[model samples]
Target: MPVIRVEMFKGRTVDQKRQLVKELTDAFIRTCGGTPESVQIVITDVAKEDWGGAGILMSDKYPDKK
Candidate 1:
């Protein structure tokens, strides 16, 4: 089984997530030679306040992004 984990800032629509998983599964199967049924993916959505970079919280770093 191939387990894939993805973490990104939240706010993506459901359709976008669906497309992401489908494309990811297809790419994994094409390159890694795994069946779609055997592929597992986990998506984690983090808020800007919960994620930090450059010694500053993302919320503060990119307030305009919110």
Candidate 2:
């Protein structure tokens, strides 16, 4: 069994996440020789405020411009 975990900033649509998992499953099966049924994927959506880079929170670094 292969378990894949992806963590990223939130805001992706459901369709995008669906496609991403499907493609990831396919790639894992192709290269790792595992069945789709045996593949597991976990997606974690992190808030910008909770994520940081260069000693700055993502929320502060990339504020919503409106």
Candidate 3:
């Protein structure tokens, strides 16, 4: 089994996540010779305030975000 972990800032819709998993599974199977069912994916969502970059929090970095 191939295990994939994806970490990103939160806010994607369910449909987007569904598509991401499907495409990832397909790619993995095609490249690694494994069944889709044998692939495992874990998505971790981090809040803007909880993640930082360039010595600044994402929430603060993008304070003007809509």
The backbone clash count of each candidate, in order, is 0, 0, 0
Better of 2 and 3 by TM-score: 2
Q: Model 2, range 1-66, lDDT digits (tens) per residue?
A: 778999998999999999999999999999989689999999999999999899999999989779
Cα misplacement distance, residue 37 of candidate 2 (Å): 0.5
Off by over 4 Å in 3: none
Question: For model 3, how does the per-residue alpha-carbon lDDT over 1-66 read when each residue is reduced to its tens digit?
Answer: 789999988889999999999999999989888798999999999888998999999999876466
Can you rank all candidates by lDDT, best first?
2, 1, 3
Show pairs that collide, candidate 3: none
Question: By summed lDDT, which 10 consecutive residues of candidate 1 come out lowest?
Answer: 57-66
lDDT of 2 at 7: 97
Q: For residues 22-42, what per-residue lDDT tens digits would candidate 1 score against the true structure?
A: 999999999989689999999
TM-score of 3: 0.88
RMSD from true fold, candidate 3: 1.3
TM values, all candidates: 0.92, 0.92, 0.88
Could you tell me the TM-score of candidate 1?
0.92
